[model samples]
Target: MQKLKWGMIGGGEGSQIGPAHRLGALADGHFELAAGALDHRPDAGREYAERLGVAPDRAYGDWTEMLEGEKGRSDRIDLVTIATPNSTHFEITKAFLEAGFNVLCEKPMTMTVEEGEEIVRVAEKTGKICAVNYCYSAYPMVRQARAMVQNGEIGKVRLVVTAFSHGHHGDATDADNPRVRWRYNPEMAGVSGQFADCGIHALHMASFICNDEVATLSADFASTIPSRELEDDAMVNFRMQGGTVGRLWTSSVAIGRQHGFDIQVFGETGGLRWASEQPNQLIYTPVGGRTQIIEKGEGGLHDDAQRLSRVSIAHPEGFPLAVANIYCDLADAIRGEIRDGLPNAADGVRSMSAVHTAVASAKDGGAWKDARPSIFK
Candidate 1:
């Protein structure tokens, strides 16, 4: 088993994602860090590299230097993880992919639809593995839900309802909360704002679970918080490919919320429901039967679901483990054992399209359309 030598372009000293990348890459013992371009500031970059245990000289101040060095030491970096702000995702990922290194990027793949679509084209040309981090797909039970939906756990899928909200930064800017200041800025994060931040994750999760394309719908969005230039709430009504109606609500404003996500599906004979806040269980109820709670590592589990229940049932697996699963699956892709699917580049484009459309509608006082599907194309 050849372990992938991994390098990170962001997630340095002050980076929210640096520690996450480290933990996720090491979770399965198949990847090890070799280098990093940790920060925009030279001193900060050097400090971040030292903190991550990279040899001082291998740490570069900018990604360009890291890319040049990695090109020469292809043996040292089989893959690069881009965990930077949204705007930089395009440049850092484009550089590594063009240099023939595989990429596992964070969600909302690019700041713009054009950039997201172009990234997909480049990946195809390079033939390198590319994936976006939509962590919900990594859940053992979520994957189980996906399989059940496809195998007809419900007689025929009819409706999807989703809600995702968090009480975060409604009254503050990244300036007020240093941790989120960058996300508040259009240049650093991109134009979609909160929609790009967490809404994409929910939208992608629904698509993955159902394995169906979202065809058309109308949407409304807003920046409900005072002095915040970006949207804080959004409502999307979707007509899925098979005429399954879906209503998705996303917000960073609903008071006292913390990473809340609940997905429910209705069909002719049964339904599927899962909540992110409680990752270990999936709710299944037959139209005429008692509801079932499908715990992550407990009994009544399918083989595929149990296999991904890598941790003990007694030991809870939360966001970090979920993030690690993305790295794990992408490693499988690099090994030629799988294809990119968990909110990969194409999904990013789709989400961006939806975000842009909702924003456009908001500006136009809530006009809606169908032809504007989510995605870069």
Candidate 2:
């Protein structure tokens, strides 16, 4: 199969996410990096794009230039990934989608729920794919968990507990660093800090695994460092549309937790647990039976899980490969195949609504608030 031409906006040199997207997009040989407006700096972005093997003519200065340049080309990119900052997602994504290009946007797809809704509508209107990078849900074991839920192997989901926490920003001294400071700055990170940054992944995972939507939520937020405008820690209590109780804790000040992300789903018949640290195994327990470990790539795995599993059993596939799974699904979707699990613009809007609702609930002393976006309602 011929590789689809791909372009990227932002996620330039030194970007934490740039390498992952590069590795993931090219991992399966489904896409070639044909164009890019990588860094905020025109010359730097052009230079970096060329260094990454993007043709010099396609190595543009910025998103606008890339857009205009690609718009006039007969062989424009089939998809574009937006790895820009949280605030810029809406503009870049909307622009690209409006111009008839598929988009894979980084999370918190927009800064506000309204923008997110607009994105959803635009994607629908343009008949373009506007995928959100909720790539954790693309993990092979997570796919197994979701498939199990869908297959009734787990019966009715009763409760979900999840967390995404880390201590990289724990130091008060480091709080002022530009990298760390922007995360807590309302101007940069918007309404919520840690929750928006990491909690949504956990929240999305809960919904993804249960095949349910968050209906309502109550939240408590805290900024441990005091200098920050946004919370560094949060606890959320939520209920899914299917009546599943949800609990999520996300923090950036938990000193010992390294990449701390995990989830446990309890259902009427069985329970399932998976952690980012142990991405290969899904721990399962029937109500009255011994716990079992479901390894990825093993026989009897659900088709989605088995299909996404690239390495042999016991061989680990880390974050980038999970991202690659997302790209894989995107490739199929772009080729006119239905990829039901691929997170879309609707998921992005719902998450924005949840974030805004969580922020409001936190401000209201942990009062319960409707978590669905108005459009959904």
Q: Can you give the lDDT of residue 256 in candidate 2? A: 100
**Stretches of model 1 off by over 4 angstroms after superposition:** 171-182, 339-341, 371-377
Please report, in order, the local distance difference test score of every candidate based on alpha carbons: 0.78, 0.96
> Model 2 over residues 63-144: C-alpha lDDT tens digits?
9999999999999999999998999999999999999999999998999999999999999999999999999999999999
- Candidate 2 residue pairs that clash: none
**Count of steric clashes across candidates, in order:** 6, 0
- How does each model score on TM-score? 0.93, 0.99
Write model 1 residue lDDT over 1-377, tens digit each, in one string: 87888888877775677777788888888898888888888778977787778888788888888888778863768778888767688888887888899988887778777787888889888998778878788888888888888888797889889888887765554335756666656766667667778776777787788887666656677777556667778887787777788888888878688878889988889999999888888899999899988888887676657766787676788777887888778787777778334556677677777677667766777676552443322
Give the TM-score (vs. native) of candidate 1.
0.93
Best by TM-score: 2
